[model samples]
Target chain A: MANFLVWVVWLGAAFACLVSALAVVSFRNPFYSALALIGNLASLAVLFLLLSGEFVAAGQVLVYGGAVMVMFLFVIAYLGDKSEESPWSGGPSWQIVGAVLAGGAILAEVIVVVGLKAGDFLSSPKPVTRDFGSPAALGRLFLTDHLLAFEVTSIVLLVAAVGGVVLGAHARQGEDPTEVHART
Target chain B: MRGPDIQWYVILSAILFSVGALGVMLRRSPLIILLSVEIMLNAANLLLIAFSRLHGREDGQIFAISVMAVAASEVVVGLGMIVAMGRRHVDLDVDKLRTLRG
Candidate 1:
């Protein structure tokens, strides 16, 4: 039964991911692309949870799929209206060919790198069933061992937040108000 | 791992990552490109946690968490910048982005 659940989770996550990817590519509308990205992120979060990585999964859903995606959609709604030109007119033919070739090369390289070694990067950590969100575990690991890295991440987020404000504000200042702004 | 023996999870991740990369290459909208980048990062994160589980390691989970945190910061700033640029140009198309292009 447990095994069945795991497989089910895996299947569902993969399907969601595939759909989201297609949506990302298929949609010409930037808003729809943003929405698809949200779906993709949510599915990936579910994949994380299925693998028993609960904290990361929760963060994936909350921080990324939730907050960041909404931020992106806001941008889309703001900018996409004025240009009525489809962003999906597609790229130059040569560029598409180049992209395909480059993607293939990267895929081949990754296949070489990640090759035949499921055993290398994994070991059975205490399963989520045994303990979920034990603040003590997070605290101990975070404070003593991972504190420096954690501090760096805080700095990064601070930068991102401040940068967002400064940059977003600058754009508002730059818009040529005489022409059409994003139509509602 | 033999090509066939590679767990479905690993294969799926690689596929997703490639799709994300392709999307980045093909999409004209900055927002779409950003989404593609996020897809690539999530693929990496998925692989990280999967490895942690297969090996019974907490370190992998911890690392994954750190990556997630950093990813959040990236989105906040990165999207802000993209949107800023979008607003200014009123054009997020990749072609117009050649301002920096040599």
Candidate 2:
């Protein structure tokens, strides 16, 4: 019964992810697109839970779904959703065709490469230990083998925060009241 | 009863990645392009976790966590640029983003 429930949750989350992803790219309104992305990220968190990645799943919810989605929504709110000149007008005709062809080619290559030994690749080597996805195991790895990488990530985030503030402040200082009024 | 195979997850990731790539190439709005990039990043993260499970290793999940951190920082800077550009009444189309002087 527990296994059946797991399967149901996995399938449902997977479907939700796919649908929301499509909505993200296809939605014309930026606000709607941002909302779709939130859905996508949240469902992805659920999928992570199914994969026994408790740490990653929590991070996905907090970082991507919560923080990142708020950033996106803030942008959408600041810059009101200006409808495109023509809906569904993605780009120049040739650009659209090229994008489609390139995406299709990449998809085909991935399918071909992964299909050969996919069965063996999918099966787990052994039953997962109870502590596999626990915080203790992950924290131990972070402190030991992955310590340098973790510190580097922290530095990167610090730089990004400082840079974002600098850039945003500069932009605000130079803002033209005329343009703001025009938009309003 | 058995769980869903890793192949399903992998294939889903690939499809999502492809869709993201298409959005990046075809979309004019810089914000949408940024959104597409986020999708691609998530797709890659999904693959990492799947492989981690298959190997019964924790390395891939750790890498995924770091990827998420980087992604957050990236979007922060990108959105800042977007806000700056919007202030100038600059075109949101990435093709015209070459000039920072405005």
Query: Candidate 1 lDDT, tens digit per residue, B1-102?
Result: 111122566777888888888888877766677778888888887788777666655566777777877777777777777766655554666677554533
Per-model chain A TM = 0.77, 0.86
Instruction: Assign candidate 2 its CAPRI class.
Output: medium
lDDT of residue B57 for candidate 1:
56
Superposed on all Cα atoms, model 1 deviates from the true structure by an RMSD in Å of: 5.2
Every model's TM-score = 0.82, 0.90
> Candidate 1's error at A146, in angstroms?
1.0
Candidate 1, residues A82-167: lDDT per residue as tens digits?
42336446569898888878888877777766665445342223344344333456557778788887788788778878887787
The whole-model C-alpha lDDT of candidate 1 against the native structure comes to: 0.70
lDDT of 2 by residue, B21-91 (tens): 98888777878888889999999999998888878899999999999999999999999988887877776
